[model samples]
Target chain A: MIQLLANPQRFMDFSKWAAPIFGILAVALLGTGFTLAFAVPEGVEGSGGSGDAIRFLFFHPQLATMSMAIYAAMAASAFFGFVFRHLLADAGARAAAPLGAGFTFLALATGSLWGVKTWGTWWIWDAKLTAELVLFLLYLGYMALLAAIDDETKATRAANILAMVGVINLPIIYFSVYWWNSIHQGSSMGGNHLGPDYVAPFILNMLGFAALFCALWIVRVRAEVWRRKAGALAVQAAGKS
Target chain B: MSGLGVLFRRELALAWGRGGGPMLALPFYACVATLLPLAIGADTGPLKAIATGSSWLALALTSLLSLERLFERDFEDGALDLLALGDEPLEAVCFIKCLVQWLATGAPLALAAPIAAMALGASPGLTPLIIATALLGGLGFSFTGGIGAALSIGSRRGGVLIAVIVLPLFAPPVIFGAGAISQAAAGLDWRAGFALLGGYSLFFTALGPFFMAAACRNALS
Candidate 1:
């Protein structure tokens, strides 16, 4: 399977059909999932659940998990890109970042909105929230490194190293925040579970979002490959002229 | 090893004389410490409360000021290529550069941290702990910050790129270092934070140069 996707042209060909299929599937699944989430009751008013905004659950967990899932995927591809030095792996890793950033931004924003409703404050430096913030910064750093470098191969190489370093650093960041919270007065904002009514939609939405990420990632990777190919072709045509 | 010593001494002298003078980061650190009071008004109590944290933060920010120049001039002027092609391994080159950086910027900042803290209204008793934490925390920063500097060695957007690269890596040391002082202030087991701070420095020491060398090689290639 890895060998198969190692070829950029083959990967592009496969992604052509796969991207739209996942995109349509994601749309249908998420559309139904949001409708189901709204139908869930606020669950006995004054309870710690985020009240009517409890519906935000469907978006938040999936976004949070998907953002992480995408980082993990990006890091894995980065590992491959660096170790194997394959263009497809580099393209996939590069393409996953902006989509992952979008997911992470939404996760942080939605989670904060949920926090506002439940915690009675706009923000608290909870460990989980702080960890997410760090993750978001990590993503931003990767994108910035990618954008700043003039050479395509060097940019990918440097960004891959950063990604690898980040993947290692994530656990340390999380653990340090966790320990720091424990030492400080760790706020117990505990009512953020998918309720019985919300469970089905939450699961469905998570799957949908995962599909959406996959579709976008494939599309972006294809675009990168085409961009590189066009650049090579332009050089070759210039040489002939 | 002697090669490392020579490199370290040379970098230290060069960095010292490069801009305004030796220990340029100190005034930046002090100036930052000074500004916090102005920005927040003459509120010593609140400033005192955050003295340890703010000083460490100032140290981190000030460290960034000098770091983009750590490798940029060397890479641009081709000094880095000669160093890479020299007798010492690139890893050792990385290690020595980070050491010089830590000594030139981080160590002095560590020694000056207590003064900065005092200037920001911290009591005299917290001075020793604050200095210790800053020294170790600053050490960690230099090592990891070297990776950032090396990675963005010749980029046009060097400073901002270096910050973005190093900021996330800076979190653990800041947390551990500040936690130590705060724990000491609270009359708790501050040694645990101290141990973690030491561990954080050692963690970067072991791995930081490896990454730096890789980044330098990438640029060199």
Candidate 2:
């Protein structure tokens, strides 16, 4: 299947339309999700305006989950690149870094805001929050490493190794943080604690956020592919001259 | 493994050479430990209470400082290519290099951890545990950090990049090591933390080489 897309022309043709379809779907889904999320009856109890904000506050975790999912996706793509030595996988992995970082940041920021409202602090070294921050840094490091290298293949290969190594640590980080959280004195925020009425919008925003991620990922990969093509063309023209 | 002993000795020697040895991290750690007292107000009681934990943290951060040079300096000076070409597999070479780093960086940090802890006002009773945990945890940091250093070889900025990649990966060891030190200080059963630290150290040293070797290969290519 990857071989079929190996041809740049075919990839361009397929993604040209597919990318836009996903993008439009992403915007529409997000729009509807947010609208539905805000439409819910305001307030958790006595917090008044905060209740409405807190109602959709679960989106923070959804964004975080998507962020990690993006990193996992990025790692898997890079792993394929490592195993198969395919350029598309390289492009896909490279393209996902910024998007992953963005989601991770949003997750943290939203979580922080939620914390200020709920926990009365902007930040806490709670295991979940800390782990998400680390993951965000990982994304930043991946992108920084990619940009720092002038050699394209070398950059991609090094980043692939980092991503793969990072993926191995992901489960460890998650479990360790899980254990750490259990040991700590946290006023634990479990998913089930939220009202049953809020579950619908929570799940909706989850899918909507995921759709937005996929849409951005597809478009980003296409852009990287085109950039590489342009670079190759310039090199070719220089050689001819 | 043909020249394993020779390679180890040479690495140890090179690690000790002027401007490259373990001394760099010692002073940096001291600086970090020094700042804590000032930051928290130098009340000896609080300082003593937090000393062991802060010392362990200082060890982790200092090892990180030393780790950025694990592969980068060698790669830059062309020593990495020669090592890669040698009879030893790159994986084994990476293992040995990280071992050397552990010896140079981790060993001293461990040795100093006792004094550092005491200086920060920790009781003498917990000194042994602090030393032991630092030794094991430093190896974990060294090995895991070796991967980050190797990965950053072809990249321009490495110090911060290595920290970014390595710190999250360092959490387990940090928790286990610091846990052991603090538990020992508190006169609780600390053996579990020690066991976890040992597990983390062994795990990272065993698997870190593969990624380190792979990253070095990519950087070389």
Candidate 3:
């Protein structure tokens, strides 16, 4: 499938239709997910019952998952771009970073709100929270490197290397933070702590967020493709003049 | 092999002469140790408690001081091109550069680590462990930091960009290094943190060169 869409024109054609479909799907799923989650009465999903604050589960986890999923996808695309010399792969990697960062930020923000509701604190240096924050920093670093270089190709190449390094280091960073957290003994929200009733809406919102991400990623990649093509044409025209 | 030795020595000399040896980083380390207590209030109770951890934090930040010039100088002077075209692989050159980086800068910083920690009111008995962890952790820093330096070789914003790129990578070492010292200070088994720190440094030392070389080639290209 990647080979079929390796050509920029094919990607452009595919995304033109695919993007809208995904966007519509995202809206429909998110709409349904939110309605279902809110319909569940306060105090129904947990022992201590966070009331309406339980709705954050539908949003926060999905955004956090998307944030991580996008980084993995971005790194994979970067690897292909660096190794196979695919321009579209590079463009895809570049387009995904800001979106990933946005998702990560939302995840952190929502997680913080959830904390305030349940844990009575706005922040704690929990293992998962620290790891998410580090992931956000990684995204920022990737974007900064991409923006700092003047030459587009060099920037892409450098950022690709950084992405690869970040991916390799991600697990180590997570483990280290977890180890440190163990010594400090922070409370973590375990999977078993939540009621099974919350699973359905959570899955729905996760799917919705994934679809939304796909739509945005395609649009950004298309924009980059067009921008590069326009630049090429302008340079050619100047040479003739 | 002889070429690598020469490269190692040459990097050491360049680091010492051009970058002011460890003069820049040591003072920065001391200043951080000094300023941290002042900022947090000089109460002996709190300062004594955070002594080792804060010193580890300072070490991490101090390592960032000389990284901006790690590859940028060779790159700007056209020497990186020569190194790339040399008979030896660029990966080996990167390894040697990072090794020399540790020797010239990281080692001295490690030596200064215990002093800074002691000044911060860490127990004096923790001094040897502090220096040991700092030495190992600094190796990890130098190697991992070499990747950031190489990646930011031709970047417009060198220093801050390097910090933003590299600081997250510094987390593991800082955790392990500080954790080890704190474990020892509390008289728990410190071996686990020390072993983890060693493993982290070894892992980076083994793999960091390939990434650094790749980044350098990308910048050079």
Candidate 4:
């Protein structure tokens, strides 16, 4: 499979088709997900249980789920690049950084918005928020490192190493919430904390967001590949002149 | 002594002798350290906090400012290739070079902290801890900065590139070093903070050389 995709021509062909399909699917899923997310019976928890259960979707659980899922996808792309030596895999990882970063920024932004509503403050130095901030910076750093290096081969390998290092740091960032008294909440997605009542829309949003990420990632990767090709051609033309 | 010792001495000599690297770095560190407090106003509490941080931050910046000179000259002159193929382990050589670098840049900055500390109105008791943390933290900066320097070899805009790659990793040291002085100033137990700084230094000290050497070899190849 890796060898088949290793050929740039084949990968380009695949992306030419895959990009549009994913983009269309992303639009559909995002439309459906948002409608369902907002349309869910409001104030269902109503004056009786846990203050307001409907508002829960707008808070930590959804954002945390999106952040982790994006990172997991990035890590998977990085692993594929590392093991299979696939250029598309590496390109996929490179392309995913900015998208993942955008999602992280969204998570942080929404979390802060939610905090302002609930905690009456714009920002809190809670462990989870800080860790997520660091994760965002890690993505920015990876992207910067890729842009900084001149040689394509060198940049890919350097960025790969950074992404792998970041994956290791992600767990540390997650666990730091427990290790310290941060303003961020503890795990809400997995284990005993995630009950069935909340799991449905959360999973829907995760799938929708993950698909959105893939759509963006495919578009970005195709753009990068084209840019590189154009750059090589320009260099060759200059040499010929 | 081993080949590492010989490399260490040679690097130290190159860094410290007349017209040596430290001549430029020492003045840079002094100027920056003095200029910061002036920029931030003379208030004692903030000054003292900035004072401690500026000590390590200045060292980190100066180390970065001078980092391109680390591998660029050697790389341009083809000396790095020889070192890559040399009998001594490149990792050990890398470690020694980092030590020499810290001595040349970080050591002077550490030594100069007291003057800046006084200027910033930091209490006398915090001076020793500031210097100690600077020394250890500066060593870590040198090691990590060397890796960034090595990675950016042969690249355009190497200076900015090195800074971007290195500054994030540099955060832990700055936090711990600054935290130590702040805790001490607050009359809390600063030993734990200093120990954390020391542990950070140890972690980077062990890990940096191998990664730096690998980066160098990759660049050379």
Candidate 5:
């Protein structure tokens, strides 16, 4: 699979059809998930669940998972780019960052809203929440590095290194935050044990969001490939002139 | 090894003489300490509660003050290229630079942390723990902050960019260090936080050079 996509032209061709299929899957699964989620009678999710706020379970957990998953994907691509000197991997890393950031932001927002309904506050210093906030900042830092460097090749290399470093640090950050939170106070929020009915829709929504992310990532990587080609062509034309 | 030693000494001199040495960082640390009471009002109750954390915050920011020019000055003057081509690996060179950065800036800031904490109404009894944690945490900051400094070498908005990149990386140490101090003040077992702080510093010290070296190479290329 890596060998097949090593060529930009081949990857572009593959993604042309693949993106649309993923998009269709996303729409169908998300539609079904949402319909089923809403069809459940209000205040009847899991035992001791937070009423209608439990509906957020459908969207928030999936978004939160995708947010972390995308960072992993981004760092993996960055590792490939840094190690093998693959430009496509670099492009993939760049393409995934903003989408990851968006998912992270949505996760935070939706989670905060859920908190408001259940915890009676807009925010708490929960370890998971703090780690998610750090992840969002990490995304912003990545995007900023990409924007600040004038040379595209250099930017890719620099940002790739940063991504790899973040991957190494992320677990440590989570652990530290968890430890810090534990020492400060006991978390009032208990874990939600999902019932059998909530599981299918939750899985469906997660798959839908993953599909949507994959589709968008394909499209963005394709765009990045085109942008690089154009940039090279412009440089060539300038040199000739 | 000898090459690294020489380079280390050279970087130490430059870091001290060029940037006003500890003077710059100390004043900045002092100002942050001074500002906390002023900004939050002179109530010792609230100030004491935040004292250790605020000192850690100041140390982190003060470490950042000197990082922007960590590699940029060398890169601009072509010293980085020379070092990259020398008998020493770029990794060692980066390690030396960050060590000097810690010794010149972070070390002094670490020493000042207790004073700042005390000024903010932190109990005088917490001073030793505050100093120890700050020193280890400073080591972590220098090495980790070096990665950010190296990454932003040729980029625009370098100062602010380094802060953005480094501060998130700084979070773990700050939490561990401040947690240790606060835990001690509360008459609780502080060993876990202190051990974690040491582990964080050691981990970064071991691994940060590779990242910094790679970033420096990226900028050089």
Candidate 6:
């Protein structure tokens, strides 16, 4: 797969077919995931279980999980780009950043909304929230750096370094919940069974979200490649004159 | 000792002797520190609580604002390419340049912070801690800023570009440094925070030179 996509022409060829497939998958999975997220029953324990259990899906665990998963995908693409020097991998990294940023915004916004509902506040200086805010800033920093540099190669290198550095903050962000007396709940995905009722939708949503992320990533990568090609052609035409 | 030490001293002297560089940073820092209280209001209680952090943040921003010119002048004059290809290791040279930069920017800012702290209603006992934290934290900023400056050479709006690249990396240091000072100002045990700041300074001190040199090489190439 690496060898096949190493060539730009071959990657372009592959993307021609892959883009529509990803687009369809993304739209389908996202539609399904949101439906399940909103439409599914609140489980048997519902209003009777620990308030923690009742409020779990409102913000903390699900959105946090999605945020981390999106970053993981970006990091994975970045690793591929760095290790193999794959153009497609670079495109993948570039594409995933804005989408992952959108997820981060969702996580923060929803988390804040949940906080307001539960804690009677819109925001707090809790470690986890602060770290997520920092992650959002990192994403903005990456986008700004990419846009600032006129040279694509330089932009890529600068963005690549920023991504690598920003990824270091993720572990700190996750552990902030554990390390401090944060209002954000501990991970629900860890430890023992999630029980079939909750587990099924959780797993399905995660899978669907992951697929949706992949599809969005592929679409964005194709657009980025085409933009660069167009930019190159414009430069060439200017030189001809 | 001879080559890098000589280079180091020269860089330090050059950065210091240039009246505008170090002097310019001082007023910028002072103005920024003074403005925060006005913006946030003169409530002494909150000002006292945030004095240390506000001062450190002001210094960080001032240092960052000045960092762009750290290598830009040398690079433009073709001195950086020569230094890159010269007998002295670029990493060692970069390390020395950053040391000089910190001495010029961080050291002076540290010296000046007490005035800002006093204006912000900081207690007398907490003043030294603010200075110490600024010095240590400034070292880390200069080192990291060197890497950013090197990486951003020849880029548009290089100063802002370098800050965007460097500021996030500087977050841990800022947090620890400001926390230490804030704790001290609040009459709390700040040792742990100070220790963390020291650890970060040490870590970045060793790591930054390598990245800065690599970036300088890339820029030169």
Model 1: docking quality category: medium
Q: What share of the true interface contacts does candidate 4 keep?
A: 0.26
DockQ of candidate 4 (2 decimals): 0.28
**Sliding window of 10 residues with minimal summed lDDT for model 5 chain B:** B12-21
- Where does the lowest 10-residue lDDT sum fall in candidate 6 chain B? B212-221
- RMSD values for the candidates in order, in angstroms, are 1.7, 2.3, 1.5, 4.7, 1.4, 4.0
Whose TM-score is higher: candidate 2's or candidate 5's? Answer: 5
lDDT tens digits, residue span B7-95, model 5:
98788888889565697999888988888889999988999899889988989998999898899999999999999999899999999
Residue A202 miss distance in model 2 (angstroms): 2.0
Give the CAPRI class of candidate 5.
Answer: high
Best by lDDT: 5
Instruction: Compose the digit string of candidate 5's lDDT tens values, residues A1-241.
Output: 9899989999999999999999999999999999988876555533334578888889998999999999999999999999999989999999999999999999999999988887778899999999999999999999999999998889989999999999999999999999999998877666677667788898999999999999999999999999889988999999999
Clashing pairs in 3: none
For model 4 the interface RMSD, in Å, equals 3.3
Per-residue lDDT of B1-221 in model 6, one digit per residue for the tens?
A: 68887788778778878575568888898789878988999889888777777887887798897688888888899989888888989888888988888888888888888889888888777777888888898888888788778777767778888887777777777777777776666567888778877877876789878767766665665
The residue-by-residue lDDT of candidate 2 on B86-168, one tens digit each, is 88899999999999998888898888888888998988887778888888898899999998898888677779888877877
Model 4 chain A: lowest-lDDT 10 consecutive positions: A43-52
lDDT of 1 by residue, A87-144 (tens): 8889989999999999999998888787777666767888988999999999999999
Question: Candidate 3, B152: how far from true, in Å?
Answer: 0.7
On residues A86-153, what C-alpha lDDT tens digit does candidate 4 reach at each position?
Answer: 77778888888877788888888877766665556778767667677777777777788788777777
Q: lDDT, candidate 1, residue A14? A: 82
Task: Provide TM-scores for the models.
Answer: 0.96, 0.93, 0.97, 0.79, 0.97, 0.85
In order, the interface RMSDs are 0.7, 1.4, 0.6, 3.3, 0.5, 3.2
DockQ each candidate and list the results. Answer: 0.78, 0.68, 0.89, 0.28, 0.89, 0.37
Clash pairs, candidate 6, are: none
Identify the runs in model 3 with alpha carbons over 4 angstroms from their true place.
Answer: A44-49, A190-197
- Tens-place lDDT digits, model 6, residues A14-50: 8788877766775676566555555545533323223
Off by over 4 Å in 6: A13-28, A41-63, A72-85, A169-196, A231-241, B185-188
Candidate 1 regions exceeding 4 Å error are A45-50, A191-195, B18-22
Query: Which residue ranges in model 5 land beyond 4 Å of their true spot?
Result: A44-49, A238-241
